[model samples]
Target: MTTDTIITARGLTKTFTVRKAVVEAVTDLDLDVQRGELVAFLGPNGAGKSTSLRMLTTLLPPTSGTATVVGHDIARDPAGVRRRIGYIGQGTSAGHNQRVRDELLSQGAFYGMGRRAAATRADELLESLDLAPLATRKVLGLSGGQKRRLDIALGLIHSPELLFLDEPSTGLDPQSRANLWQHILDLRREHGTTIFVTTHFLEEADLFAERVLVMDHGRMIADDTAGNLKTTLAGDVITLGFASEADARAAAARAGGTAAGSSLSLTVDHGELVLPRLLRELDSVTSATLRQPTLDDVFLALTGRSLREDAATSKEEINA
Candidate 1:
């Protein structure tokens, strides 16, 4: 592993035997995560996102391949890797009957912190995550958002250099999601913590992360910035409406676009530049509109499916 790389994995693979059938959870994966980078890992259900995170966090060993996290080999030195990383899974970590402050303090103590130091760190985290007012409240009495906040506090009690968050904002309301994101950003800004997160929320990944890693069917499909993926994979969609169907067909023929009834649609890399040139050439254009490609568009272009739909379907299957 390089000095700046906090995580390095090569040829990683994991498989499970389920009811006499084999399931490949991750396959021949290679990855590197640099220090202080806030990266989002995105995929559908059973797409290896969580599997990869578990391998990297030393929670689950890969069946084959090698990985080094925080300068320690994942298989050979899991304790070393664990000491330098904090993992907050999908569910809350605090005990239901414990006070929020006491839970945090207990976490610090588990890391071998002195009573005074644990109390100090507990108070600091409560204030930072906006859980100070509810510090004395029992964990079971707290709302969903508050419980998640306490989970984060529990993960950070030891101030690990790297943090792994699995569906951190999965069940939060929009307002609570906003608040959680703010606190997460604040943690990165103040502590330079390397954050590796898995989320189903497309907009959250698009707006918050510096880089995105997309996976499908146990394999990594794409790795790049959200803007780059949208620009390169699924360019801007340009739609032009004409007064007559014949005019739309003519415009489509001239612009190499697809025509449907009275509208011509074409995708171009730079809509701003293409729109002006197109309008000048096509005199019969009655209306023109440009729609910028989003991260979902990139996914659709790559896999012929939508991540949003996958998430909804996954939820439905779980309920069923």
Candidate 2:
């Protein structure tokens, strides 16, 4: 492991027995997450994401190998790991009968905080999470957005060193989801708590993570900044269309130096990645379109399939 790594797994393996057959969920996997980094753990459903998280958080034991969370061995120091990490599963936090504020305060007090300190911290977090107006409301009466926010406040009440969020904003409305994302940014900026989260939203993974790790079949396939992933994916394509077939053909030939696609009524002759002097050729052309490279392109290039497809296939394998 590197000097700054806070989460380390070496030769990690996990297996489960179902019926009369043994299945391997994770095999000889090595993972390292740096301190103070918000790492996104993503994959198709049943890609051992929840299982891996459970092992790290001490909810389940690994079949073999070692993992250390926050510098504490998961096997030897389960309590230490628990004390250092706050986990929010893919579920709601509120009890139907409890008040939001009361729930938060109780969470704080459970961690040995005094009543006064717990109450103060709870109120502060309630306001910070935009739950102040709903602080006194019954959990059952709160909106989905409000309840999720309260769940976050509860997760943070103890000032944990790390937070594990599994699809924290899965069912939130767009506005609520945006609010939650901003809050996550603020949490990292203000408290420096290292976070590990999982999500199916590719856009979220693209935008939020400083560095993202993509996984398939419980194995990591790629890890890098989103831009870098896109830049080296494929060759560029330029298309030119015109009003009339002849105009289209002329424009296409002028830009592409050949014919264009069938849908392209105009007549670009050839469609190769590298055409002759593109600028010089297109300088005289007026009607044309260019497809800039993007992360999706990179994802497809790297995975040999679309991200959505990879996710679905992974889900099937996991289920099988």
Instruction: Give the number of the best model, judged by TM-score.
Output: 1
* Candidate 2 wrong stretches, greater than 4 Å: 1-3, 234-277, 283-286, 292-295, 309-320
Please write out the lDDT profile of model 1 over residues 188-248, one tens digit for every residue.
9988999999987889889999899988888999999999999999999999999999999
* lDDT, candidate 1, at 224: 96
- Judged by lDDT against the true structure, how good is candidate 2? 0.74
Please identify model 1 stretches exceeding 4 Å from their true place. 1-3, 315-320
lDDT of 2 by residue, 25-102 (tens): 766668888878888765666666777777888988889989999989999999888888888877787788999888
